[model samples]
Target: MNNKPVGRAPNFTNACIVMFGVNITWVLVVIWSLWGLLAAVFLGLGVNHLIERGRVWAAARQAASIRRGKRF
Candidate 1:
């Protein structure tokens, strides 16, 4: 029986890790000082941008790999 998993699991894992790291950093910033709230807001926005870009990159890479007849 074939046991290989399907789809972009690595990309999902990377995205989740990035999101978790961003949230933890934000929490730490909030705990550090009230002044850090602004920084946290910007950080959150940056993280969102990064996640979107990463997904796009991953999808493109996956498609290329598929076209090459290989698993990503």
Candidate 2:
């Protein structure tokens, strides 16, 4: 039996794509106004931070489930 944990590569890829898209939109906004650019940067960073935190939380939850021998 293959007993390895599932990797989070797909989740990481999705996170990167989402962040990249947000940054691109922010760049466009920057061309419209300085304040918009600042807001985009701040919001983008905050969102990305939240996503990372969620990822960590999910991973921990999965690990706990595995320890309990619970299958999803």
Candidate 3:
């Protein structure tokens, strides 16, 4: 049984995370296509912030889990 993660999973979050072997999505592009540059710019900033927040949250959770002697 081979158990190993290739990379980050695909999600609606952002294309920054490579999945399998590629950057899965171009959310900003889609937004720009449907809307305009102004919308894409503003929404893109929000998404960037969300990614940062998610990183911080993940780090905190990982630290807590380690302190409790847990591993996944």
Best by TM-score: 1
Please give the distance, in angstroms, between residue 46's alpha carbon in candidate 1 and its true position after superposition.
Answer: 0.4
Q: What's the TM-score of each model vs. the native?
A: 0.54, 0.52, 0.52
Off by over 4 Å in 1: 1-28, 31-34
Clashing pairs in model 3?
none
lDDT top scorer? 1
Clashes of each: 0, 0, 0
Model 3 off-target regions past 4 Å? Answer: 1-27
Considering TM-score, which of the candidate structures 1 and 2 is the better prediction for this target? Answer: 1
User: If both were scored by TM-score, which would come out higher, candidate 1 or candidate 3?
Assistant: 1
RMSD of each: 7.7, 8.9, 7.9
Flag regions of model 2 displaced more than 4 Å.
1-34
Report the C-alpha lDDT of model 2 over 4-61, residue by residue, as the tens digit. 9998654587888899889878675875486666677786788789999999999999
